[model samples]
Target: MSEQDNATLIEVKGLYKLFGSEANKHMHLVHEGLSKDEILAKTGHTLGLKDINLKINRGEISVIMGLSGSGKSTLIRHFNRLIDPTEGNILVDGTDVMTLDQNQLEQFRRHKMSMVFQRFGLLPHRTVLDNAAYGLTVQGLSKKEANERAVEWLETVGLGGYEKQYPSQLSGGQQQRVGLARALATNAEILLMDEAFSALDPLIRSEMQDQLIELQEKLHKTIIFITHDLDEALHLGNRIAILKDGELVQDDKPEEILLNPATDYVEAFVRDVNRARALTVETVMQPQICRITADSISDALKQMRKTDDDYGYHVTDDGYQGIVSQETLEEAVRDDNGDDALCEKVYEDIPIVAPDAVLEDILPETINADYPVPVVDEEGEIQGELSREAIADVLSPDQVPEEAAKASQPTAT
Candidate 1:
């Protein structure tokens, strides 16, 4: 798919799974929806997952998070058909994974998706080189090509020199690197990571997260990572889905979940987050924009100076428009014609941006760009000013207090 196609990559509809036999006392409870007591009374088996629905997008990272036995792992396992949904539709890239026959399901699992698990599943008997190449080898490539690809992935995963070593010779982190190499070698568009770093030490886990970020940047692959750690979810997920008892309680961008969790359970998960770092331009950009034509530079500048904002300004054929800035005003003033000295100046090109850009995030762009960047609508119309000072103010710890104190005191002429 092209980069612009933000279509759903994976979709799940009302997925459900239950475990029990006819003699299981919980059989009646299963009809009512199994509770702990009902399951214990009816049969020993527990309900692993309940109805769950989710969608994953193309080329984005979505994290699934929950405590142990919350059905997180069980839900992810259903993605590649490792566990089939008892009654639901799982559409992977538009194909119904649940509807796939055994042969088709096997082919889909082998080729369409790749997985990384908490335990590094490298072959004990095989050399690291062979273990890394196992996926390609199974795909019917020649030994030479598979090894070549394996070596390439080894280098990709930063383990270039350990190709011939056995699994026993590697550290836990190193073995996981081998597992990562094996997963990437498949070149699957969708990657499923099931607590891939949960087994590593804290420091090692952090390092692995860095590596994962780097890999995602380079490959732009769509990923679904499962973890119980809220901090890890915040650090790595573009969006997160919180599951409890096989149900998705919350699925949203990290900031949304942090700022407004759906439940106390989810709120507890995000209570300690550093919210400022997680926010983006998409959240803080001003909604109001003033349109400016080339001839109305002075007016635009005056508006900008009056508002003390630098966002949502534009230069259209009618006149200069957007978030006003002194710089924009000055540029517009420079375009003034002799006949309308106050209105004539016109700036041909104006920088434009979305309203959601946070202060610090947008300041450097405006400071370095040719003009005050115009906060624009999705269609590129001037919406507001993206001011450097606004960003600086937001980044400055004492800005609010200083501004308040100054405002409260009389100003010197």
Candidate 2:
């Protein structure tokens, strides 16, 4: 795909929505700082969204989260023009959705986007295969072609061999799989899931979330997921948009929301969040580090003696070489028989982590580990190092976790 298509698939500018006959006329009250209740009492209009400016990037899950009546559901419907905005522009792939006529809108929904409903929305009389092929059939594919495409997606969603079963015969999770298969069968560029797993059992919901994540890795479809649950949003969203009383309160990554909530309401939502699962190794790693390019064991030992720390990273201009402890170099200087390779690397087996690895995933590696963890990028180059002390600080009850927005970026000395 072109870079432009992958940047921002949807962009909402100056968006506002209110439920009343004269909703557009009452928008000035919202801009004047009138609360939702006040507007309802004075203008007889219930505000759904007000001045919501957001960008939903391609190939990422952008979650819209809010409590009941917070307009999250209303906002999502506006994407496909199911509910028109009272005021503002909704741009999808650089085309204003409001400008599309009925025929154009129908074609847009069929080709550009597909939705998975929360209630599974499966036709009861149809078999699983027919239900899964619903979208393809709607798009005018023949039964033979639609069924073949649906079968592949059904298998992909782990519902293989159940094509003949009716919706009533399958479990809730299985029925949801049918819904997901139907959405994926169309091969649309965008997937809209509005609280898709909220009705299932807790365990089933968790499993579906995992499956969705796995599917996203392979398909890379732009997804807009709606959920009220903070845990669900944190788990699924690459970027989260939190709403309160129809106004956007916070829009940020999960770690930023946890570390530095934009408002009190957002803070309350993330107050009890487990830091280990939400944060990654990238946030805690110190990238601005000292590296020694020593050519000899005596030279390496002399360089290490100047630093107060016990260890040093041995790296060239290209990338990381290895780590050397002052004690190891001291021993090497005394024991080396004029060997040139002595200054190359002290230990071959050291704990290392990827920048994107969650802290929880790498917690066990740090336990009783004598060495500092090296942070490596995807290009197999070392970017930074992580210390156990840094990990403990965030986990400590007495320690105030560093501001995540600041911590995630490199600090200039």
Candidate 3:
């Protein structure tokens, strides 16, 4: 998981939920080490959740994922107190949700949290703009102000021209855009999305995932998304919480889960995942140990020779410039007499990968590039370098087929 500061946005502690007419009566059975099936068979009470302890940080997407009866949805409902916990507490920014009165809970849900449901929960009679502005309107904003804010968010979610159309008129994806626009229009700090994109077709689902990622980069809303799809969890989550039989089995970042699964259940979820797409350049990059300025041609060549490498990165006060090949430096030393000769020899057209760029994206560049690809940040600052060997190391399987491993090697050009 990402190293979050002590500042926690939502803290769920010892949370348990039982579904039955006399649920509270079965609390002792739960305390006595009764299994979910045993408790259900004896008391006719379903254990919706058991001792769910999680700390949701601010401005991060925390995904809850599991199979059909895994209680993933049940865990999220407690965030906004949609379902009351049979025992334990849910503290939102230090306020116990279980203690909130009806009025206070209503106010909290209106201003602090917004929900996007799987069924596109848009009212068929209300126009797109009205549905988007529903939260603002409920909060007593004037129609003019509410519509203005809704229009801006609708445009933000790519639904600008559909403001006057009804939900029945728009396609499934467009309707979900309206749903997102509705959630965004509220300006709620916490967003609870329950399989919000699951209803869409595969292509539209991918697009919505991309859109959510793009929006999160700009908005940074504290989102708690629920999904059974492991790919969706891996793609959208900054942290993922996996539930199994009403209990949390693991909670961790995507790469951590991929590299070190907590259990066989998690391993099964990740076993078929394309690791290259899940791992980023930051995960495998080496420190940029060999670097030289444009003025240091001889020094750069010496460093390259000592390291047994053919190239070194050209850097400046601003950040990274590009790669400098030993051949370029040797030619410059032999032909150019000027002090700035080394500067002219620096290859400024070298390939670059961003720190956040996935390994799958970097593979093509690494395979084709003559020199090691420099991993740069948004400001063009060189963070590290990635080699073809490093790529192969990360992609190597634990139990590789003999011929497959041999065939996977990149041929020299």
**lDDT tens readout by residue for model 2, 1-413:** 77755698899998999899998788889889999999999989998998999999989999999999999999999999999998899999999999999999999999999999999999999999999999999999999999999999999999999999999999999999999999999999999999999999999999999999999999999999999998888888899999998889999987788778899898888777787877888877786365667766677777777777777777666677677777777777677632455444564356778998988788767543566778878776888888766777665353323443233345689
Ranking by lDDT: 3, 2, 1
CA lDDT of each candidate? Answer: 0.73, 0.86, 0.87
Misplaced by over 4 Å in model 2 are 1-6, 303-308, 315-321, 336-340, 343-345, 348-350, 377-379, 396-413
Q: What is the C-alpha RMSD of each candidate to the true structure, in Å?
A: 6.5, 4.6, 3.7
TM-scores across all candidates?
0.73, 0.89, 0.89
Q: Candidate 1, residue 19: CA error in Å?
A: 2.9
lDDT of 1 by residue, 69-107 (tens): 788999888898887666678888778876788888777
TM-score quality measure for candidate 2: 0.89
> Which of the two candidates, 1 or 3, achieves a greater lDDT against the reference?
3
Candidate 3 per-residue lDDT over residues 2-69, each given as its tens digit: 34535579999999999999998889999888999999899999989999899998999999999999
Worst 10-residue lDDT window, candidate 1: 337-346
Q: Candidate 3 regions off by >4 Å?
A: 1-6, 304-310, 325-341, 344-350, 396-413
**What shift in Å separates residue 372 of candidate 2 from its native position after superposition?**
2.4
